[model samples]
Target: MNPPDNPSANRWLVTACLAQVQAMRYTPAGLPALDMVLEHESQQHEGGGERLARASIKAVAFGPLAERLARQALGSCWNFRGFLAAGRGGKGLVFHIQDMQNT
Candidate 1:
């Protein structure tokens, strides 16, 4: 399968998303304020194992407005980026931008 491109590949986009997400202060509302290249990081342990790893999570805002915006942004980069929730402990959401054209 081919990876998707990042909507927030541009610094401006990332900054905009980050700022908006933070300003919104609500996951549902904040989600739309960001570009599609945004991903939430989550940390967890494996079953019966003393190992730690990151996991990718497909996130969707719990509201119609947010979901619509998120979907719109994500759709643009769906072919170049993977929505992953950081498995490692972190303070906030991490946006990983990929160069789909290069890949």
Candidate 2:
């Protein structure tokens, strides 16, 4: 299916720490793939109250990004630019990372 005409509509930018990383694997097409978890914690104002927001999200990167992420140290923080999509079997959302930079 074709993507939406407005690319920014689905884009997601998150700043979080790398919580865990699995062994690098290859797709059937031989492209490198990496799966990992990212942890985010911050304080935000909601409903006129201060709230602590914490999240742990499942994420994946493909090809060169995957390879590069594999070499990064766990617990490192980064600014991740990506998009979200349903995972295999139409399960929960998975963040498909497109680019990242140290934070």
Candidate 3:
């Protein structure tokens, strides 16, 4: 038996506080675009003990979602649903947010 290739597991979701929101911009295609950093902190059980997990990730949203996100205040918490992908110019990872809601 061979393992099947499955990329559907690339989905990512997290609840985090928004910070450093850039001014709304338009893409070459004229779609609204927004970029920002997300700060996440939570406690999780690890090694039978509680541990704090913290991270800061780069995130971007486009189109109507971007327009909506642009209106959100910094430091606001949101539940973000997205997928990870290599950032433009193939540098590091970027969270391409598909949808989000206030947390």
Candidate closest to the true structure, highest TM-score: 2
Task: Give the number of the best model, judged by lDDT.
Answer: 2
For candidate 2, lDDT tens digit of each residue in 17-91? 999999999999999999999999989999999999999999999999999999999999999999999998999
- RMSD after Cα superposition, model 3: 2.9
Better of 1 and 3 by TM-score: 3
Query: lDDT (0-100) at residue 60 of candidate 2?
Result: 99
Give the distance in Å from residue 96's predicted Cα in candidate 1 to where it truly belongs: 20
Predicted candidate 1 versus true structure: per-residue lDDT over 1-103, tens digit per residue: 4544975333312112211222222454353332333332334467865554433432223334343444343323232332333422754554443322211
Query: Lowest-lDDT window of 10 residues in candidate 3?
Result: 1-10
Give, for candidate 2, the lowest lDDT window spanning 10 residues. Answer: 1-10
> Every model's Cα RMSD, please?
13.2, 1.6, 2.9
Lowest summed lDDT across 10 adjacent residues in model 1 is found at 12-21
Tens digits of per-residue lDDT for model 3, 50-73: 999999999999999989888888
Please identify model 1 stretches exceeding 4 Å from their true place.
1-48, 62-103
The parts of candidate 3 lying over 4 Å away from their true place are: 1-7
Order of the predicted models by lDDT, top scorer first: 2, 3, 1
